[model samples]
Target chain A: MAVDNASITEVVLGGTRGGPDVKTLREDKWWKLPLVTVLGLSAFVVYATWAAVWGDSNFFYLPHNIISPFYSPCLAHACKAAGDTGSPVFDWWRLSPALIILVFPLGFRMTCYYYRKAYYRSFWRAPVACAVQDARPGYTGETRAPLIIQNIHRYFFYAGLVFNVLLTIDAVQGFIWPTLHHQLVHGQYVTQSGGFGMSVGSLVLCVNATLLWIYSLSCHACRHLCGGQIRSFSKHPIRHKLWKFVTPLNARHMTFAWCSLFFVAFTDLYVRLVASGTITDFKIF
Target chain B: MADVTMRIWRGDDKGGQLVDYRIEGNEGEVVLDVIHRLQATQAPDLACRWNCKAGKCGSCSAEINGMPRLMCMTRMDQLPAGPVTVTPMRTFPIIKDLVTDVSFNFEMAKRVPAFNPPPAPEGGYRMAQVDVERGQEFRKCIECFLCQNVCHVIRDHEDNKAHYAGPRFFIRYAELEMHPLDTNDRRELVRERMGLGLCNITKCCTEVCPEHIKITDNAIIPLKERAVDAHYDPVAWLGRKITGRKKRSADEAAALRP
Candidate 1:
C-alpha cells in the first residue's frame, strides 16, 4: 500500500516554539539560553550578600572550638556551663557572612556539568536554539567562546573535594565532642569526654564530604566530560584509582552534585547552632 | 497511514530549489532507506553521501530539514511529515545534490605537524602504561567531522575560520599531546595559532559523534590542560627545556603537517 501525506507526521521537533516573526525571522546565532542557570546563579549572590551581614560568624573559626569536640569532649561541657545564651545570636552572624561574599564566584561558577551539555547541543547545530535556518544552510558544526571556562571544572572537582572533607570534619567534630566526658563537675549538663570512636566518626564525615567532592569533580559522564584529550591515558597507580572512583561519581554526578550542595548548608548550620546556643556545647566533667 | 514528503535540495552552488519526493516505508525505517527507495524508483540523479549505514564511518552526514545528522541513522518515523526534507552538509560549499566540499577538514588535517617520537634507540622511551592507555582512548576517534559539523565557530560565524581550528583539529592536537613517544611542542601552536581556547567544551561534537569519542574531555580538555601547562606551569616549562625533545604534536608523518 502507498503511504500518503496524511499517514506520516513529524515527531521530535526540539525545544519550545514562539517568536515575534516566527515564519519570516531567522533563528538567532550564539543564543544565550536564559536557562535557570544565570538567574539561579544570581540567587547565590543575593543570599550570600544577605548572609554576610545577617548570619553567624563562627564558620571562620577553624580548629579551636571544633577540634576540642572531637579530641576532647569534656571542654565543650565546661564551655557550655560558662556559656551565655546571648552568644548564639552573635554566632549566627559570624558563620554565614563569608558564604554571602562568595556569591559572585558562584554566579560565574564554570563547574556546571549541565551547562556544558546544553551548550554543546545548542551551538553545534542550534546556536539559535531548536530553530532552523531556512535560507540555504551554510554552516559547519563547531563551538565558540565562554566555553573556555571548562578548564576550571577539573580544579573545582579538586577544590570541592577538599572543602567537603573539611565540612565533614566539622560535622564529625560536633558528634565527637557530644560523646566526650566533660570534667566540669561544676556544670549543669555534665557529659563524658568521647574516646577514639568519636574521633574516628568525625573523620569519617570529613571523608564522606571528600567523596562527594570527588564525584562532583571527577564526573566522567557529566556534561563537562564531553570533549577529547590529545594524550591517551597512562595506567598510573594513583590515576587508575582516581578514574575508578570518579566513574561511579560520574555515573551519578547529578545526585552527588545536589548532595554536596545540601552538605554545604548543613556545615553552616552546625556552626550557627554552637554559636547561638539552640544546640548546646555542654561540658562533661 | 499518510504519505511522507521529502523536499530534497537539488543542485550545485550555481542555484537550486527544494525538489519533492514521496516514498512508502515503515516509521522506524532510517532516512537512508527512504532515499534508497527513491533512488530505485524516483530521480536517480539525486546525489547523497553515505558508507557503513550503521552510523559508523562518519560518511552519511546531511541536514534533514535543517539539522545535521547521519541520514542512515535518522528514522523516518521520528520526523514531521509536511515535507520530509533532505539536504547536504551546510558548513562546506556544495559539490552537488546532498554532497558538500568537506575536503576543508582534510586540508586542515594537513596543517597539523606529524608525530616524531623520542629518539632513544636502545630503550624506546619508557612511558608509563597508564599514560599510553590515556592516549589510546582518544585515539579511537573516527574523524566523523560531526563535531566539526556541529561547532558554532564554523556554523554561525564564518569569520572564525581564519583563526579557529575546529574540534577535529583539537582532537589531532590532543592526540599528539597525549602520545607517549611524541616529542614536538604543539602547545604554543595549539594555543596561539590553533585557537584552542575558543572551545568552551560544550561537547556538541561528542553528542553528534557516531564513534562515541569523548571529544571534549578526552581530547579538547587534555589539550587545554597541556596549553595551560605549557604557558602557566613552571615544572612543564623546565621539563621542556631540559628534554630538548619537543612535546608530541600529531600522529601523522612529516608529509601531513601543512
Candidate 2:
C-alpha cells in the first residue's frame, strides 16, 4: 500500500502552536457533570473527615453491636470500654479508631480507576470536559511524587479485600442480637440464645457491603486480575468464564463506583446517628 | 433514488461552518462515496482526505454524525434517515473540511524507542508462535489514529498532548516490549516520557477502535503492570537495589539466557 503522506499537509499557519486556539462554543450541559462531581466528592470528603475525627458514636447499638463501616476493625484501646465490639490491633495508640483502617478504603477510592478520572477532571481541571482547554498549561501525568503512589492500586485492592472481609463479618454480626444471658467463649464474651432478625442498620451495612463488593469486583484491576495476563481464553475455561461474568460489571464500573461511595458514607452516618441516639434502629424482622 | 442532505464542515484555520449540500445517494454506498460524489459533481473545491476508499488505508478518519468512524467503512444505509453531519476529528487541529492535523501522532511515534533485538542465532532469530500472536493484535493498527482522537487524555485535554502518548503508541510499545526476540526496557520511558500513567482505562479508545483491538485490556493495562513491577513493587525494587544490576541491554540478556 502506498503511504499517503500528501493528505497530512504541514501548512504552518501560526498562532498559538501547542493547544487549541479557539475556545469551544459548546452550549451543551457539559459544566453540569464536573460540577456534580465536585459537589459530590467534596460532600463525601467533608462528611468523612468529620466522621473520622469525631470518633465518639461511630460504633452503634450495643445490643445489636452494629459497627460503622467507617470504623470497622476499629484498632484502638478506647473502643472496647465504650461498650462496642472492635478488634484493636494495638492498645497503645490513643487516637481516632478510623485513623487506623480508613487509609485502606481511602487509598482504594483515591487510586480507583473511575475516581481517578472523576477527580482528575473535576478537581485538577485536567481538561474539565471533552474538547475543552485545561486550566493547566502542561501535563506531567502520574509520574510525580504523590501521584506515583497510584501505581500501588493493586496493593490497595488487596487491602480493600481484607477490609471487605472484616466489614462482611461486621454485617453478619449485626444480625445476632445479645440476649439477657451471656457466656465466655474463646476468652471473649459470647451472646447466647440470639434470634434471627434485621434492623435498618443491618440492612444498610449489608447494602453497603454489597455495593462495595460490586464496585471492587468491577474494578479495572479486578478485571485485569480475572483475565488480563492470559493470552488464550480458549485454553483457560475457568478464567474465561470469570472474565465473562465480570465483563458486564466492568461495563458499568462507574455506576458501581459512585453508588458504593455514597452508600459507604451513608452507612457510616446511619450508624453514627443510631449511636448518638438521634435515630432509632427499626427492626425489619 | 433519494437525496441525502450531507452537512459537511468547510473552512480553514480562521473559521469554519457546516455547509449543507443535497447529494444523491446510491443503493449501497458508503459515506466516503457520497463525499467523493459531492467532490466530483457539485462542489469541486470541497476538501476531504481519503485513500484506498477501503477501510485499510486509515486516511479517511472523520466523525460522522457525532461519532468517530472511518468514512470508507460507514455505510449510508446504516445511518438513520436524516442529514448526516461530517466533520474533522475533534482531537487535532483542523486544517480544512474533514481534515485535521494528525502530526501529533507522528511526533509521539518519533519519541518511542526503536526496537533493538539481540544478535540473531546461528541461523536467524526464531520467535515462538505464541510470542508472535501476542503482538499481532496491535500490529493491525493502520495508523488511522482514531484511537488517539477518541482518547480522553489528549482528546479532552489539549495540554495532555504534550505529555500523554495516547493509545496508538502504547500498543506500539507493547508490541516491541512483549516480542520474545526483542529486548528493550521501555517501561521507564512509557512511565515518564509517554505518560502511561495518564490513562485511567476508560476503554473509550478500545470502544472506538475499528480493528477491535483490546487496547485497554491488552496494551495499556499490561504496560501499567510492567511499570508497577519495575518501579513500585517493593520486593522487585529491593531485589534490583541489592543486586546492583541495571537494565540489561538486548544482547546482554540474550547472551545470559543461553
- Which candidate number maximizes TM-score? 2
Stretches of candidate 1 off by over 4 Å are A1-96, A99-108, A111-162, A177-212, A216-255, A262-285, B15-20, B78-83, B119-133, B234-258
Place model 2 in a CAPRI quality band. Answer: incorrect
Give the alpha carbon lDDT tens digit for every residue of A1-285 in model 2.
Answer: 222344433323222222123444333466798999999999999998988887555465665668888877868875775566666787787777788889999999999877887888788877566545566766656767778788888889889999989889888988987673564322335464666778888888889889988988988777766764454555666876787788689768889998998999888888877766777789787
Best by DockQ: 2
lDDT of 1 at A108: 23
lDDT tens digits by residue: candidate 2, B1-258? 499999888877777778899989999999999999999999899888899988898999987775678999999998888888887887888777788888888867756666777777798876556456668999999889988876767765566677677899999888877665655577777776578988766566776788999897678877887777667778668888999967543333222221
**lDDT by residue for model 1 over A1-285, one digit each (tens)?**
122334222322121111112222222332455344344435544654444445533332221134211111111222233331112222333233344334322422344554455434443333433223323344322223344445455555445444445555555553533343443322234454444333333443464456455555546422223222223345344445555555555546546554554444454455445444455443332
Task: Report DockQ per prediction, comma-separated.
Answer: 0.13, 0.14
Q: Which window of ten consecutive residues has the lowest lDDT sum in model 2 chain A?
A: A11-20
RMSD of each: 11.1, 6.5
Supply the global lDDT for candidate 1: 0.54
